[model samples]
Target: MTVTDQLSKVIDKTSRLIDLCAALQEENDLLKLENDSLKLSLESREIKKTELEEKLRVMTLARSLEGIQPTELGLSEKTLDIKQKITEFVREIDKCIVLLKK
Candidate 1:
């Protein structure tokens, strides 16, 4: 090929490569933004889950305490059972948070 023709071809190739690189960089930026959004969404979900778990724990304790016979039986048994149930629920909630973190 003539020197001029070879140089023209090289310029064309170089131009195409530059365009491709620019396009790839744009795509990479978009992907990074999408990933960041997903991470935020996941963190929000984890916080909501934790809140719900805590509410459930509170509801459970409230329900258990509501039906107890405070007149005849001493407060010791009811308090003990509530403490145990609270401990168990807290442990379970901890496990759930650990799993979510993973």
Candidate 2:
């Protein structure tokens, strides 16, 4: 083959390589964006899961308290006070969770 023909072929190949590189770079950028979005979604879900767990704990405690008899525990006079304190604690936890969401 002539040198001119070889040089032309090299030029054509170089052009194709550059085009391929650009396409790959675009695809890489898109993949990076998708990865970042997925990470953020996963983090949001994890935070929600933690909040749900806290609520479940509060519910469980409330149920346990319900099943107990204040008279049997010999604290009938303090039963109302204890219930009021528990209610306040639940309210505080809810406020904390709301702050966390922000």
* Model 2 TM-score relative to the real fold: 0.67
Predicted candidate 1 versus true structure: per-residue lDDT over 1-102, tens digit per residue: 999999999999999999999999999999999999999999999999998798667656755676764445465645756866887899999999999999
Residue 58 lDDT, candidate 1, scale 0-100? 68
Error of 1 at 47 (Å): 0.5
For each candidate, what is the lDDT?
Answer: 0.83, 0.83
Number of clashes in model 1?
0
Superposed model 2: Cα runs more than 4 Å off = 68-86, 89-102
Q: Record all residue pairs in model 1 with backbone atoms less than 3 Å apart, i.e. clashing.
A: none
In angstroms, the error of model 1 at 71 is 22
Candidate 2 on 35-101: residue-level lDDT in tens?
9999999999999999879866765576576797555666554565576578889999999999999
- Candidate 2 yields a Cα-based lDDT of 0.83
lDDT of model 2 at position 58: 61
